[model samples]
Target: MTIDPEASPPRPPGRPRSREADEAILGAALDLLIERGMGATSIEQIARRAGVTRATVYRRFPNLTDLLVRAIEWEYQNTQPEALSWPDVPAMIRDWAGQLSVPRSRRLIRRLYGTVDDLPELLRAYDTAHGSHRGRAVRSTLEQARTTGQLPPHTDPETLQLILSGAALQHLAAYPDTTEPKDIEAYFLAVLRQVGFPAASPSPSRRSTQR
Candidate 1:
């Protein structure tokens, strides 16, 4: 028997839904994931936390993995890095590190890393999206440094790009519970100094503080 198209059940009506609902749902999902971690979160819990029906959540996201991947993308878009200054690399690194160290963001990231083996496809997508932006930013910053003479004329931007990216990730993983922002700032500044950036100016109380 042929199915009648018009006889199919009608889509439930609402005022034309807001595109913002998608953003809201993603944001809520990320928040819940951060609060509860991966193992504890569920589709039903996310729907409840997002204040939408489970069907609505599924309509937007095919599964928990899809929801998580989209939520990570949404968070990345919301926190796009600002323009960088060549002379301010230390401060920029510190700021980026601080953003990553935030409790919720850190928790989500930790959970994502933990599940890489089980959800390689989702992890690949997450890595591609995040790595693209990070790589672009690293290249831009290094290029600007070369143009402005902050870095040596012969310094390889590509090499510096890898170095800076690896250093940032390593530091974040090593000091997940960073308490002093200044300490983080100092660590990056030390890297720059080793790479030939001039040492930062001494604080006015440097002599007293040292004693």
Candidate 2:
């Protein structure tokens, strides 16, 4: 017996729902933001670049801002450097600095800062998503340092954490166009020194090791 194509249970309304499409849309949104900045990115552009219909895009994201926030969050969650497990404070700070200096991460951060004034709400969303987690990590690292006596008696982890985070953000904003590896390293080291970590030295013995 010949079977008719229509006889196949009508496959859900249109192209089968695809998780891949959702990821593609999010990825495209992130790439566009980094390349063109938030003001120039639109839902239509995301849909087109993601190879999905506008309706499909809407099915995943209600609006451009929502998509943008999700895209940033997704990228942050997936791209965050693996948590460092250094035995002491200075090493942890150095590891954090190295992670932040990664080229793609630096670009994403610079783009985010560039759009902050125009998209305050989106920036707020981004902060709310990443800030809490980051704060906790900073607190933990600082507390560990305090317990080990790596930090001075007067040092406050919360205040220092805010300073470090703000400084790093500002540094990225200040040098969005310059991708010099040494510049990035120097910026972080400057912040570290400002916060009381000694300037990094070529020879380990030249620096007062903070363990």
List TM-score per model, in order: 0.70, 0.73
- The residue-level lDDT of candidate 2 at 115 comes to 74
True-vs-predicted CA distance for residue 4, candidate 1, Å: 25
- Model 2, 1-211: lDDT tens digits are 8544533444466766677988999999988888888878999898889877677788768899889988877876753534534566666666666666676778887777777787776677667667566677778888777666566656788998888878777776665544555666666667656655642333665444654
lDDT of each: 0.69, 0.72
Ten-residue region with minimum lDDT total, candidate 2: 198-207
Query: Clash number for every model?
Result: 0, 0
Off by over 4 Å in 1: 1-15, 18-21, 79-88, 121-130, 176-178, 199-211
What TM-score should be assigned to candidate 2? 0.73
True lDDT of residue 49, candidate 2: 92
**Candidate 1 local lDDT, 1-211, one digit each (tens):** 9653423453567646557668778878888777776778888898777777677777777899889888877766644455333345555676666656566655666667767787665566666667566677767777677666677676777887777767766765787564466766777777776776642445779967987
RMSD value for candidate 1: 8.1
